[model samples]
Target chain A: MTYCLGMLLKDGLVMISDSRTNAGLDHIAVFRKMTIWNEPGDRVIVIAAAGNLAITQEVIHFLHVGVTLPDEEEPKTIMSVTSMFEAAQLVGAAVRRSYRIDGERLEKENSGFNCSFLIGGQVGGDKARLFQVYSAGNFIESTADTCYFQIGEMKYGKPILDRALSYDTKLTQAGKLALISMDSTLRSNLSVGLPLDMAVYHRDSLELGMHRQFDEHDPYFAEISQRWSKSLKDAFLALPDPSW
Target chain B: MTYCLGMLLKDGLVMISDSRTNAGLDHIAVFRKMTIWNEPGDRVIVIAAAGNLAITQEVIHFLHVGVTLPDEEEPKTIMSVTSMFEAAQLVGAAVRRSYRIDGERLEKENSGFNCSFLIGGQVGGDKARLFQVYSAGNFIESTADTCYFQIGEMKYGKPILDRALSYDTKLTQAGKLALISMDSTLRSNLSVGLPLDMAVYHRDSLELGMHRQFDEHDPYFAEISQRWSKSLKDAFLALPDPSW
Candidate 1:
């Protein structure tokens, strides 16, 4: 299981991903689920994927090497795309390429070719956009009403984002919300662990302002985790313990 | 969809269930998910069901009507059971009866005969026990270590329970926690709605207390929901905002 979230706020895009993947509890590994493509000042795209690591990696590989469309003679890659939409299309096309190759074999073996990505970036002149790209190679863009997308182990961390987030939220605030969300998920699920890859992109800056790694002992996160737990308990105690 | 949770604490049992049942979002109804069989001073059993309304209704009806186990010619039921374990078996047997009659037909129709129940109560000298009876009719008792069971739309409300609950929690406190859990779920899911049925049974006390229906305007619940939401927001805002 994994938890990845991408927020497209007025100030910027906030991306957070937990770096734990497991075939089973005993087979756990620290697999970074986040991928960043940066041509600083020109384009910066961050993609976080969860589900079927093989399929996700293959899609990324396809994106890296480029893929020729079903009827087209030439290949289009993320690096070669003109718009963020085109970049999303290229990523989706790569997913399709992976489907064409191993999807059937996986199904034959009773394994799903499951994968999804949260893609966000700015290219050339258009404002930054964020999308949730699905395993089927289709995607949906985030609008003002829905300024965020979460993939994998989503439910456990969703309430906070649903209640507190909006496009106008400050980048730092959005990052804090994202961490709080992640903290909730990590506390509830063992499948999602730390050594988080968090990147905060300032809308038109096209540069990652804060791309940091967080482990179990990361001071700020530890403080937030401990503090959040204490705050919640304190809050629970502060509530009138039912008079029933 | 539904959301029901049963927690067995050192002080007692906390059971909460939402009454919203929907064949689809277009076909919604308020069918209470909770039922209680209390023969004061003798036994008390609370059952909460989720999934396949028809199947759940049939199972409950079977329990309501009592069942004669094969080879044991007597028709024993929750009211007749002398121990919580036997009461759980009666509930399980009721589920199996529903399966025996309609499972195949539903399977043929591609609609799963799925339903689960949380059965918790005390009978005679047996301490209060909580069992999560699955669709297969097999059940697992809630031990001190794993003290809670949730069926349907559970994740959204899981974090608070994971953090705030312990075996020693008072019945009223557990009830408050359950309501808070339900409040979180209601905010996140439209399918799980109001008019929740909450039952908090203290150990050794066969009579039910604080059994209430929390509708849109139910005053006590209104206070709980409002205060709880405000506290969460206050706590969230109080958490250190990101420095980056």
Candidate 2:
């Protein structure tokens, strides 16, 4: 299990992913799940994936090498996509390609071909966008009414995002909410752990604004974790006890 | 889908269950998921269920009628159980009996025999106990270190419980936490909804201390829902935005 979140705010896009991966309870490792394709001033594509590590890694490999859609004559890689929409389509095609290669084998072993991706960023003149690509390879973009997407172990962290995030939120504030959401997930689930990868892309910059790795001992993350927990406790205590 | 929660606290037990039952998105109805067998001064047994409505209903029926264990000649009903552990066993036995009657048929339909239960309360000369009965009819009791159980649509509501609940929490406070947890779930999930049924049992009282049903119009629930959202937003704003 893993946790990855992407928010498309009015100011920019904020994306975060955890580094824990596990084949089972006993076999766990830190495997970074965020990949960036940045060609400064031309395009910046970011993808955070969750699901079968092998499958997701293979999808990333396809994105790196290139993918050929049925109607296309030439293969297109993430770095070469003309627009954010093309980037999302390339990701979907890669997922489908992975399915064609491994889906049947996995089904025979009773393992579903599970993989999903949160792809977001800017490409040249196109507006910044965020998309959630499904295991089936189909994808949906975040709209004004729904400006965020979360994949993997999402529920524990969702209430905070649902309550706090909006399309009008500032890019930095959205990053803070994403971290708080991840903190909630880390506290409740063992499969999602430390060393998070986060990236902020300022709209239309066609370049990454900020990218950082957060692990244990990261002071800002530690402060956010401690202070958020304290605030939740304080808020809970302030609620009046039921008189009945 | 449903959400049922039970907490075993120093003061007693707090149990809450939603009343929504759905066959599919097109088919939904309100059916109370909680049942209580109160034999004053002898025992008080509360059962909250989640999963296939037919299977859970059958399990509840078996509990009410009686279940005869392999080693026992006489069948036992929840009200007849002497200890809280025995009450759990009775509930488990009821689940197994339900499986025997419908599990294979449901599996043939690819439904996976889905059903689980949260059972808690006290019996004469016994302490208050909380147990989460699984689909297979096995159950685990909550310990001092982990004094709560939640079944169905549980993840959205879990973070608050993990952060706010404790074995030493007062029963009323635990009830408040449960309500807040339920509010979070209700906000995030359409499958779990209004008209919640909650029961609180004071330890050694051998009877229910308080029982209430909260609907959409309930003022206190309305207050908690609004205030908690405001508090969470305030807390999020209080966290410093990332400088990077």
Candidate 3:
């Protein structure tokens, strides 16, 4: 299992993904789940994937090689997409390719075709966008009413995001929210482990300005995790008890 | 769907269950999920169930009518169970009976034989106990290391319990924790709704000292829900920002 989330904020976009993947408790492994396709000043597409590692990797491979859209003479990679919406379409096409290649085979082996991606970034002058691409290769773009998307092991961390985030939230604050959300998930779920990848896309920058990986010893993440836990406990204690 | 949780604390037991049951989002109804068998001074058994409402109701019915135990000369009722463990076994027997009556019929209609239970209370001289009974009629007791059991839509509220709860927690504190946990789930999930039933059994009392139902207009629950949201937001803001 994995957990990946992205927010399409008015100022920009924030994306975060956990690196741990496990087929079972005994077969746990660490593998980076974030992929960035960047052409500075032109387009910067950051995607975080969760679900079957093989399927997500295959989808990423197709995106890298360029996926062909129907009626289009040439294949278009994330770098070639003219806007964030087109980039999401390109990602969706790659997901479709992965399904075509592996879905049936996995089903035959009694495995469900499980894989999802959080695509968020800007293309040239287009505003930063966020989308949750489904296992079926269909996708839903985030809007003001729902500015964020989360896939895989989402429930544990969702209440915080649901309560705290909005489309107009500051980019840096959004990044912090994403980290806090990830921290909650990491603490509650063993399948979602450490070494997270995060990307912060400033609005209209068309460049990946801040892409960082946080390992166990990363001081800032460590601080956030520790402070958040302490703060929760403190907050819980401060609440008035039920009158019996 | 339903959300019911029980905690076995050194001071006593805390059990809470939401009152919503839904066949689908449109077919939702308010149905109490908690059952209490109070033989005050002798035994106090509280059971909360989740999953197919019909199946759970059926299991409760079997328990009320007295369920036949393997090789037993007479059926055993929850009121007659001598120990907390036997009360759990009696509940499990009811689950198996429900399954025997409805499992194949539900399967034939493409529905699952889904249901689970959280049983917690003290019986006679036994220490306060907690067990999570499964659909298969098998059950697992809570221990010092893991003193809480939550069945149905559990993930949304689990992080708090994981971080804050332990066997040594006071019964009242555990009740507060359970309420906070339920509040989180109620906020995050539509299926787990209001009008909750809560039971707090104090150690060695062997009586149903506090069993109350909080409806939508309940002031205490409303206060907790509103204050918790505010407290969480305050806690989030108090955390340090990412050192970007």
Write down the lDDT of every candidate, Cα atoms only. Answer: 0.88, 0.92, 0.87
Q: What is the lDDT of residue B25 in candidate 2?
A: 97
Best-to-worst order by TM-score is: 2, 3, 1
Per-residue lDDT tens digits for candidate 3, residues B3-36, read: 9999888788889999998877789899999999
**What lDDT tens digits, residue by residue, belong to model 2 across residues A168-198?**
9988889999999999999999999999999
For lDDT, the strongest prediction is 2
- Every prediction: chain A TM-score: 0.96, 0.99, 0.96
Worst 10 residues of 2 chain B by lDDT: B64-73
Q: If you superpose only chain B onto the true chain B, what TM-score does each candidate give?
A: 0.96, 0.97, 0.97
Candidate No. with top TM-score: 2
What are the per-residue Cα lDDT tens digits for candidate 1 across A47-146? 9999999999998888888887556678977787778988888888898888989999998998888999999989889889998999899999999888
The reply for model 1, stretches above 4 Å from the true place, is A69-72
Tens-digit per-residue lDDT, A62-169, candidate 3: 887899975687998776778878877887888888888888899999898988889988777777788888888788999999988899999999988888898888
Query: How many angstroms is residue A88 displaced in model 3 relative to the true structure, after the best TM-score fit?
Result: 1.6
Best by DockQ: 2
**CAPRI rating of model 1:** medium
Docking class of 3: high
Arranged by lDDT, best first: 2, 1, 3
Error of 3 at B39 (Å): 1.6
